[model samples]
Target: MIRFDRVTFTYDGCARPALRDVELTVDEGELCLVAGRTGVGKSTLLGAVNGLVPHFTGGHLQGEVSVDGLATHTLPPQELAHVVGRVGQDPLSGFVTDTVEEELAYTMEQLAIEPKVMRKRVEETLDLLGIADLRHRALRTLSGGQQQRVAIGSVLTAHPRVLVLDEPTSALDPTAAEEVLAAVTRLVHDLGTTVLVAEHRMERVLQYADRLVHVGDDGRVREGSPAALMRDCDVAPPVVRLGRLAGWDPLPLSVRDARRAARALRDRLGDAAPDEPPATGGEAALTARRVRVTYGDTVAVRDVDVVLESGHVTALMGRNGSGKSSLLWALQGSGSRRSGTVSVQGRDPGDVPARVARGLVGLVPQTASDLLYLERVEQECAQADAESGAAPGTCRGLLDALAPGVPADRHPRDLSEGQQLALVLAVQLTSAPGVVLLDEPTRGLDYHAKEAFALLVRRLAAEGRAVVVATHDVEFVARAADRVTVMAEGEVVADGATADIVVSSPAFAPQVAKVLAPGRWLTVEQVDRALAGAAAGEPA
Candidate 1:
């Protein structure tokens, strides 16, 4: 259904090709997962399917890319709209309408489909992706995850033969991610749709993928079965990593397969478990009393009271539209707070100037790119250093640590989603604030990038800075967080130690924790350490 014949694409200013000599084919009704490291041309490859590469993006193309035997170079995106539907990383950028229902129907209206058929497909898509409640909500009022589902629904309503999704589940919570993936699988299985998805969170989609197209650092692409490629794939889910760690044959791609293979390994380290770290017991870095945020008649946060310690990492988790972003914005003191008091270091950040608030609490919002306005990466870094009164190269240093090797001269807009996120995080961290808040920081980051970011979060806490990350990446929370706070319907539902909060919930548990059930393991690293200690005859 889709074919890339010796396709090589290079952006206007880049010295090297983003994708070079990529020959690949996707059979009809196949779910092909495109996997790679951050900024390694995964999006570039996906954009080529519908003529967005050389045509719209102004890049040089060497060979041909075709969908349904029609060359993309000959047919523009508008002409290919009937056969190919594309959803980008940032969903809000593609939205044209004001409400969820209108956005979903806009595509069909453009395609000039029958009104009755369009209405039927719109309703089916709303139910398929589980967004029936959001049909009447304003696009701007919805949460990031909700907007993402709407974006996908808008495309799915068109009923294109080939669906190309870029990080389709990046903004979704665990259950929402499952629902979206299940819907995509159904499209491939029941409806014979050809789907190509490029995602950073492979744990959610790897099990359902029929083929894996891995884009390596050298701009080359390799295609194979999930199990065949996972054996040596650098970017992999925790389940695959765990299978490699245990030397399991045909590395398990799902939690069930890993759990079935883990019985003997579980016996080897009998009664051995990870040691729980003691609480930080540090002074309160920030205190919020009676915080409330509302939008018209909708209350986003309702009289929430919480304390952030001086040296700790807190993971704020919830489903889509659960007020995680609203609460984070309120705590940062920049966003709207209908009624509340936020105290940071004995001062109310809400009453202070924006500059003062930065020193008190720095925030990397859900749309991290909104914070970046400079032309080049180095310029942004330099400006961040000057604005925060930090030493030279401080922001750039942080960027290198978070996501290394980003070109200094590249435009911030030109950088990949993960790189853009890292740049914004670096800009925020340069202020050296006592408290840091990151909303969906790992949205575009791969497994290695997430590990590096988790380390950075730990380093920030170690430096006596309190950090709160609002995210749906359970694997990241399992590795990075000391405390977990789960919110639902604009209220705090559960808050406790990381192990206590995540392990008990099926929707939020990490892959390792699910595989080694009856054992309170939260990450593959913990299991690795416990097994090594047991091998050394050390105390449990």
Candidate 2:
């Protein structure tokens, strides 16, 4: 349905080609996953499919690209809109209509699709995407994840044969990402529609992809079955790490396979150790008791209670608008708390003055640039350090820690979204607060950056700091977080160790858990390793 023939594309005035001599194809109904490091032209490749490259983006294009038999370069965006539907990484930028229902039907109406047909399509899409309840809600009032679902629903309603989504779930939480991916899978499976998705959170979509296309930094492309590519390439799911150790052929793509592999390995290791009690720890670094935050008559957070201790990575898990952000803000005193008691280092967060509260808590807001207004990153951190009374050199060290190998003199706004996020995190960490709150820190990052961020988080936790992350990436939570808390409808629904929470709670678990039951590890590599170990001592 889609093909790129020896395509080489470069931005206008840029010396290097974003994509070079790339040849690829997506068969009818094929679900292809496109992945690479950030700025590797993954988004550029998607643009080539729907005439956005040479036409909209004003780039130099060479070689032929076709979609469903029509040459993309020959057609304008309007001409290709019927055959291809594109969803971008930023949810806020894609919205065209004010309300959810209206957004879903706008594309169909523009195409002169019959009113009756548009209504039926809108209803069906709302149900399929599980947003029937949001029909009357304004797009601006919805959570980031809800807006994303609405964006995708709007595109799918156009009835495009091919769907091109660029980091569609990057802004969403785990449950929301799963919701969108599940909808995409159903479209391909039930309707036989083709899907081309570019996402950094590989663990969520890798197992579902019929094929994996890895775009290299050198402008090369590798295409094959997901399992084959994961086993052979430098880039693979986290479970592949365990697969490499277990000696599984074609490495397990889903969790169930990893479980089988784990069982065999564990048997070989001779398990059956006696159970032991969890060790005791010191006082919690931060504690919230029956917390409640309200905006006028609406209660954003309700009767929530949780404790974050020093030396632990606690993942604040939940769907969008489930009170994660409100709780974080209230605890930091940046946002109001109607009724609740939050303590940071034995001091009441509610009683503290707003300016003083900031010195006690470091927060990385969902929007990466929220707290930043400086020209250069180095100057930003240095200024923060001076205000916080930390050594200037210490602040630079923290900046380097967050965005290693990147120049400090560069403007934060000039960097990629992921880099900008890292700079924000670096700025937050430099304040030397006892507790840290990261809201969707992994958004817009590639897999490599995700892994690196996880390692950095672990390091922070090891330093006896209390770290709390409000995020949607389950695999990330599994890898870096020591514990997990699941939220729904502004309440704390579940809380426990990351492994326990995912294995025991369906809502907080990744889609991989549905395939690989029992002890649910977040990453493909972790599952692979556990499987290999479990395979031990089992008869061949």
Candidate 3:
């Protein structure tokens, strides 16, 4: 259904081609996964599926990209819309209508579909996505997960031959991701609709993928079965890593496969307590009492009391629209708080000046790029230094420490999603606030980038800083969080040590925990460390 022949695309003014001589093909109804390091050519390749690369993005393309029998080189995106339904990283950016129901019908309306057919498809999609209840809700008021579901529904209503999705499940909780993926799989299986997806959360999508497409930093592409590619792929889910560690004959892609092969390894651990996060010390840097955030009649956060201490990383996990973001925003003092008393370093952030508030607590929003506005990376860093009254190179130094080799002169918009996130985080750290809050810091990060971020978070905690992250990436929360706080319907449902919380709950647990069930394993790193310690303890 989709084909790329000797395709090479270079964005305007870039020395290196974003995609170099890429050759790939997807048969009808196949679900292909595109995986790579952050800033690699994954997104670039996805854009080429529906002619968005050269047509919309102003890039130079060499060679042919054909969907079905039509050459994408000659066809613009609108012409390909009937054959290729493309959804981008930020669905909200493309939304034209205000409500969920209208948004789903917008694409069909643009395509000039008959009103009767459009109405039937919209309702069917609402049922398919299990979002029938949210049909009347405003899009602006929906949670990240709800917006994502609505976006997928909007495209599915088109009933296009091939579906192109970029990070479709990044904003979802485990249950919601499952629902969305199931819906997509139904399309692929029942309707023979082809899907080409680009996602950083490999664990969530690996099992459902019919084939794997790995896009390297060099812009090369490798395609194969999931089992074959994951055997040696640099970026893999926790289950694949666990299989490698246990010396399984065939590396497992799913938790069920790993668990079936893990009896011996589980016996080796022999009921040993799983590794725990480093102990937290120092007084509370922030405290909240009866925090309640409401929008109209909807209570996003309700009567929640929480404490964040220095030298600890707290992860906030919940379903989409579960009040995680609202709680964090309220605690940071910038978002709406219907009734709450939040004290960061003994001062209310709402009462303090913007400059003073920033010095007390720094927040990196979900779209980290929203924090950057300057033309160049260096300019953004310099402005951050000036605003925070730090040395001229202070922010630049921090950026280098976090993400090395970023082009100083490159526009913030030009950098890849992960690189932009690193830049935003550096800007937030300029003031060296006592507490730092991040919303989905690992959304677009590859495994290697997440490893670096995990290290950075640990170092921040070691330096006696308080960090709270609201995220949907469970694997990341397993590795980086000292504690986990689970939210639901705008309330604090559960909060405790990471192992006690994540391992006990199936929905929020990581791949390692699911595979090594009956054990409190939270991460592959912890299992690796335990195995290494056991091996080292043998007398020579």
Better of 1 and 3 by lDDT: 1
Q: Which residue runs of candidate 1 sit more than 4 Å off their true CA positions?
A: 116-149
Better-scoring candidate (lDDT), 2 or 3: 3
Among residues 3 or more apart in sequence or in different chains, the pairs in candidate 1 whose N, CA or C atoms overlap within 3 Å are none
| Order of the predicted models by TM-score, top scorer first | 1, 3, 2
Q: Model 2, 125: alpha-carbon shift in Å?
A: 3.7
| 112-211 per-residue lDDT for model 1 (tens digits) | 9999998899899988878899999999887666777788788888888999999989988988777778778988998899999999999999999999
lDDT of the structure predicted as candidate 3: 0.87
Root-mean-square deviation of Cα positions for candidate 2 versus the true structure, in angstroms: 4.2
| lDDT for each residue of candidate 2 in 493-531, tens digit (9 for 90 to 100) | 887767777766666665445434553445555544444
Instruction: Score each candidate by Cα lDDT.
Output: 0.90, 0.78, 0.87
**Best prediction by TM-score:** 1
Candidate 1: worst 10 consecutive residues by lDDT?
273-282
lDDT of 3 by residue, 1-540 (tens): 888999999988788888999888899989999998888878888888888888888978999999999998898898988889988788899899899999999889989999999989988999887789999998988766677778878887878899999988877888878877888888889889999999989999999999999998788999999999998898999899999988997899899888899999988777567768655657999999999999999898999998999999999988888898898888888889998799986799978887788778888898887777899999999999988899899888877766677789889998888789888888887876889998888877888778788888888888999999898889998888999899989888888888888887878889999888768888888888788877777321
Clashes of each: 0, 26, 0
Evaluated against the true structure, the overall lDDT of model 2 is: 0.78
TM-score of 2: 0.85
